[model samples]
Target: MPHIKNALIRYRIIDKALGNTYNPYPSKLDLRHACEMELYGDTNGKHISDSTIEKDLFAMRQEMDAPIKYSKAHKGYYYDNPDFTINEKPLSEDDLTSIQFALSTLSQFKETEMFQNFGFALNKIIDRVNVDSDARKSDADIDQMIQFEKSTAAKGNEFLQPLLSAIQHQYIAYFMYESFVTQVKKQRKVTPLLLKEYNNRWYLICFDSVKEKVITYALDRISDLEIIEQVGEKPSDFKADLFFRHSIGITASAEARPEKIIFSAGNIAAKYINSQPFHESQKIVLDTLEHTKFELFALISEELIRELLSYGGDIIVQEPNSLKDELVKRIKQMKTNYNI
Candidate 1:
C-alpha cells in the first residue's frame, strides 16, 4: 500500500473522501483520484502529483491540526477523530457519515412519488455534499452496515403534506375520521394547528371547531381530507411548550400543570432510565445501593401508565396515590383476566 506521506491531495477533496463512511479506506491512488475528481470534476483537468498530495497531507497535520491516519487493512487514509473540524467548520467525519446515511435513505424514495415535493432541495443538498463512496456498492451493502426500522408502507405519510399545508395557510380543513375505540366514522371540520410525529406515527394537532377545543387525531385514522377556503385564527394561547408541558407522550392538555412524578427503580432499570429518560424533566432525586430514585414532572396520562407497566417489577411508583391506585386497578384487572 502506498503511504499518505507519498501521496498528494487537496483539503476538500481529501476531506470528503476520508470522512465518508461508505468509502472508508482510500489508497494513495484513490486519494489522488478523489483530488482529480474534486478539482477538475473531470479527468481531463490537470493531473495532481504524488508529492503535492504528500505535502498537502503534511500541511493538514502540522498547520490545520488534522489527525489524519493511514489504515493498512483498508489501504486508505482516514481521520482519527470523527468530530475533527477543518477550517471554517467544514463537515466532520461524523457529519459525513450522517449525510451519507441520509442520502442513502433518500435514494430509496427517489423512484417514488414522495420526492415530487422536495426533490429539488434534496438534489441541491446532495450536490453540496459531494462525498464519494464506492460507486459499485449496492443498497444492500449499506443495509448491512446500518439498519433502521424503516416501514416502507407506513400508513398516514400520505396525509403529511396536505395537513402541513393546512397548518401553514391556517386553512379550515375537513376530514372523515374513524375513531379507534368506537369505530365510528364522522366528518369533522378542524383548523389544522400542528403536525406532530410520535413513535414513528403521524398525528395532527388541530382546533376542533365543533368541539371548540384542541384535539389530536392520528393520521392513519383520518381520510377524505378537504382543505376549505374559510380561514381560522390560530389560538393565541396554543404554545407548543405550554401545550405539551404536563404530558409524558402525545396526551397533553395546554391548561394542565405538570405534577412531580417520583419512581424507584431496580439496578437494571435505573441504568436504562438514566441513559434513556422518559421525559426532559427527568432527574436523579435519590440514589442508594438497592435502587435509584428518579423524578419527572409530567401528567399521569395513559402513556405514562403504559410505560410504568411495561417495566413490570423493575420499577415502583413512589408518590402520587392517584397513579399508584390506577396501576393497582390495572393489575387487578389483569389478574382477573388471567385468573391469577
Candidate 2:
C-alpha cells in the first residue's frame, strides 16, 4: 500500500513488542525482528535494519511526542508511563464523556450510505476509547449524562461522501443539477475543487468545463452523482481564499468588485457585532456614545443585503448610497407586504 500505511504498521508492531511485559526485555535487534515478522511474515527471512528501528523510535518520541524512553533497568524500550500506548494518548474523564456523546450523536447516521466510511472511523475511535481504563462508565450511565442536538431531516445528504471523495481524489464529477433559477435538471460534468458548508447547507466549488469558469453548486440540488474514471485538471490559478475573499456567502457576482462598506449599529447591537464580527475585514471606524460605526471591505452580495436587513432598524448603512438605497427598497417592499 502507501508509505504512510507501512509506517503505521511498523509502529504498531514496535508498540506491541515494547508493551509486552511478559515477554523478555526486547533489544533493538528484537524490535527489528518483530517489525519484519509482522511486515513480511515469518517464512521471509528478510528483516528491517537497526537504523530503521532507530528512526521509528526517534519519530515516535520526537515527532509524535509519544512518552517513549529506553529503560536501562528493563534493558528495553517502553512507555515512560506503563499505562500509556503509542496508538492514542490517554483520554481525560471529561474528554471520554464528550466522545461518548459525540459517538451517540454520530450513530444516528450509521444507517445512511453516505456515512458508511464515517461509521467505520467512528467505530475505530469507539473501540480505542473503550479499551482505555478511564472509560469505565456503563452504557446506561452514558446515555443519562449526554443528549444530542435535534437535527432536521435533509435531502441530498447521501451525495456528501461521493462528492467529498471526488474532491479529495481530484476526480471530474458528473451529476444532474437543478438550479433555482431554471428549475430544469441538466446533466453536467465539472472538476470538483472544494466542499464548503454555509448556513447548514453544503456546497461544492467546482470548475465547470462547459461554462469555462468556477461555479458553486448546492448539494441539496444535486442528484445522480458519479465520479468519472479520468483524472480532473486542477486549475493552477484558482485560490479558494481569493475566490470567496470579497463575497459574504456562496453567491458571488463575477462583475462585482470589493468596495468599502460603512455601517453603524446601536450600542446593544454594537457589542454583538464586536464580539461576532461580520467579516475578517471588519474594523471599528468610529465608536461613539450614540452608535458604533464599523467598516468592511467586501463585495455587496444578496447574502450581505439579507444579513444587514436581518438586523432591522438596529443597524444603519451609512456609506455606499447604493447599498442604503437597496435597503430602503427592501424595507419598502416589506412595508407593502404588511400593508403598512
Candidate 3:
C-alpha cells in the first residue's frame, strides 16, 4: 500500500509537470528535481534518481496504459491526449465494487428531477466500470451493509444551479428577499461571493451593494433570482475564511470582536464536545472527573447562545460576564414559559 501510494504521488507530480505549459519544458532532470522537491524535501534532503523517474514514466505508459510520450523536439514529456488524467482511467475489481456501491447509494437522488443530470452522470460512470450481473448483486449487498439518514427535500434547492452559475460568471444577481423580522419582501442586488452549508441549510454570502457590507442570505428565503448582464465587482480584499473567522454560524456582528469564551461541560457532554468541537479554536483548558473546561475564541452571536442552550444543564458558561448574563436571561425566559 505504501509503495502504491508513493508511486501514485510520483505519477501525479510527473503528470502535473508534463501538463504545465506555462513552465519551462520538463526534462528528465527537471522531473527528478520536482519529485525530490515535493516527495523527499523534508526527509533530510533525500534524493530521487533518474532511473526511478524513468520507471515511473514507463509504468504510466505501459502498466497504466497512459498516453504519455517524450518529445525530443520540445525536450520534455507530454500526454498524447492533453485532456487525459490518471483519475479518468479504469479501476480494479475492488475499486469498481466500492465505486458501484457508492453510486448505488447516491442513485437515491434519481427520484428527484433536480438531480437527474447528476444521477445520469453517476450511471455513465457505472457503465464505464463494466460491472457484470454478479457485481450488480454485490452492489445490492453493499447497499444492505450501509444506509444514509433520511433527508427531506430542502426549499429553494432548485435555485442552486443558477446561483452557482452567477458566482462562476461573476454576474450581479437580483433576488427578492424576505427577512424573518419583516413580512414584506424586498428587492436585493448583490455580488454572490461564496456558498456556505451549515446544519443542512445553504446560505449565499454576498457583497450587498446597497448595504456596502458583506451579508449572508438564506437560500430558502430568496426568490425571483435573476442574473444581470453587468459584471459584479469582486472585492479586492475579501476572503471567505477571514470573513467568517470570528463567526460561529451565519449570524455575525461587525461591531462585535472575538472574545476568549470559557465554558465547562459535564462528563458525557465533554466526551461529545471533545470528539466534535463547535469551532476550530476549541481547546481543553481543564479536565477532571467532575467536568471539563474548554476555551475558544469567537464572536458572541445568537447562534452561539442557541448552541450553548441546546446542551441545557450539561454546559455552563464560565467567563465572559456578558455571555453568562445572556444565558441567564434566556434560561429565565424558558423558566417563565414553563411557569416553573
- Superposed on all Cα atoms, the candidates' RMSDs to the truth, in angstroms, are 17.6, 16.4, 15.9
The local distance difference test score of each candidate is 0.76, 0.77, 0.79
Off by over 4 Å in 2: 1-98, 101-151, 253-255
Residue lDDT tens for model 3, 275-333: 98878899998999999999999988888999899999999998899999999998999
TM-scores for candidates 1 onward, in order: 0.60, 0.57, 0.58
Return the clash pairs for model 2, or none.
none
Q: Model 1 lDDT vs. the true structure?
A: 0.76
Cα lDDT tens digits, model 1, 180-225, are 8899999989999988777768888898988888999998888787
What local lDDT does model 3 show for residue 210? 94
**Model 1: lDDT of residue 245:** 65
lDDT of 3 at 326: 97
Off by over 4 Å in 1: 1-147, 150-152
Report residue 121 deviation for candidate 2 (angstroms).
Answer: 18
